[model samples]
Target: MSFDPAQALRLAHDTLDIEAAAVLGLKRRLGDDFARAVALVLGITGRVVVMGMGKSGHVGRKIAATLASTGTPAFFVHPAEASHGDLGMIQPRDAVLAVSNSGEVDELTVLLPLVKRLGVPLLAMTGHPQSTLARHADVVLDSGVEKEACPLNLAPTASTTAQLALGDALAVALLDARGFRAEDFARSHPGGALGRRLLTRVSDIMRSGDAVPRVLPGADFSHLMREMTRKGLGASAIADADGRVLGIFTDGDLRRLVETGRDLRALTAREVMHAAPRTIAADALAAEAAEVMEKHRITVLLATGADGRLTGALNSNDLMRAKVI
Candidate 1:
């Protein structure tokens, strides 16, 4: 059959409309039963054991990940596998969350009695509140939808959308109840961009010790240039004997000086530096350093110790490499 472009576009729009309605319908039906599910999971000492079959299993896996990342301990256990041996993965302290639009999939229903025997609370996310799964559940969450988004009204389209939205709502409510913070989320996602921004400190990414370009006030222009060249910082800090930053001189300053057409041989670090250069606390967040650099329209920033002494130096490249910006 030839593809009709206009028909395909219309179907896409209709599918989205149907799915959106299914999710919105859940908001109206949400009440005491939803609250009970959240409270039951919160009171549990062990993880939430999620299980399902086929398409529902796919959504169950995603829900488990969302729950685990948002401060709730959870994992997905395939229902068919439970009969073989995976049932051991579920403990007495854990709560079982089963997802099924029909709520009577044999593989899942077969395990319900065993889950109950283990004294694990069963939370049902199903369209049929009176189905076997819901009948066995300690808390029944109504994931019912008017119809599937498929053209034949048979596929698990709108039903899955409703399940996913309901799962998200539960995770959000639980996270808020637990007071889960962004810093806590960063700990769970150390390799992600948000993690780098929240957990990386200026000192962690800045060049410190011998890598920091610096020269004393009495140093000649040649010495200052050599320090900048060796460190490749494109700039050098002019410091007192105790390593307290007194000034900063950059390549831009050198260019301006050369434009003057004056003799540069007599210049010392103190004679050519900009005094009281902008600095950030060594312990400041790398994200905060990025904010400062963006606000000042500068690439390099000096990191200072408590005594206002030079601790380290960082540039835009350093922050980019750290994935903190």
Candidate 2:
């Protein structure tokens, strides 16, 4: 009974094997009922109100979030809370997804009649399809497992894994059926990495007005140097009188100019600028600018508006600060 490393490794492997089998079992049992559940959720005019208790409740909450974020409106409502005044959150248009391994948890079973009375569809995800919760449901999704990963076979291990897999399956199926796009998912997950890449526009992150380093084409070398130094963007855009970007001069250009042994003070902004510099539209997605920078192996990008005039300036640093890269 003393600690044994080999035995512990075997137990861990056994646990993973059991859980994997439990999830695979769901695939074999998946059929018409799963499709019906998806259809019911699609048909609903309101959010999917997921209800559960204990470990199953935790899985239910994740399912609700996955559904809600993937274009199916959904939210978790604990069964214990539903028995209380929280039941009011379930409207007539909402669909209920009730989760319980046994399908007969007292708190959950007690509320079935009331949920049915609301005239909303009830989808039961349970191991015991014959239990009261499934009997009362409009559709039954079997989340059964042959055994638990726990040594005592009492803890909700494999069963919960199966439930989670089934929930992800449901979310994926619903996402495809609804034709949900990445942009749609990004809208719901604005704080996540994908959201920043998809939802952040160039205008949102670019430096505008006085923040952008720019000088009139007629400006002297000292004036251009001051603009580039004051802005600290490592580059200065040479623009025409009407605000149209004519060219760009960067630190690289300055280094090469210094190497030529020419007097830097006598030059005008237009005299040494690189004309037809790369520019991105102000309304373009920030992700596009990242791609352009990486492809050209450059850092800075000038942003222009509809009239083809420089509107703002952006660089790899801007994209990094916005977490869009």
Candidate No. with top TM-score: 1
Native-vs-model 1 lDDT? 0.94
The residue pairs found clashing in candidate 1 are: none
lDDT of 1 by residue, 1-325 (tens): 8999999999999999999999999999999999999999999999999998989999999999999999999999999999999999988899999999999999999998999999999999999999999999999999999999999989899999999999999999999999999999998999999899999999999999999999999999889988999999879999998989999999889899999987788889999999999999999999999999999988889999998889999999999999887
**Displacement of the residue 228 alpha carbon in candidate 2, Å:** 0.7
lDDT of 2 at 256: 95
Per-residue lDDT for 211-313 in model 2, tens only? 9999999899999999999999999999988999999999899999999999989999999899999999999999999999999988999999999999999
Output the worst ten-in-a-row residue range by lDDT, candidate 2. 76-85
Q: Candidates' lDDT values, in order?
A: 0.94, 0.94
Specify the poorest-scoring 10-residue window by lDDT in model 1.
260-269
Give model 2 RMSD, 1 decimal: 1.2
Cα RMSD for candidates in order:
0.9, 1.2
User: TM-score of model 2 relative to the true fold?
Assistant: 0.97
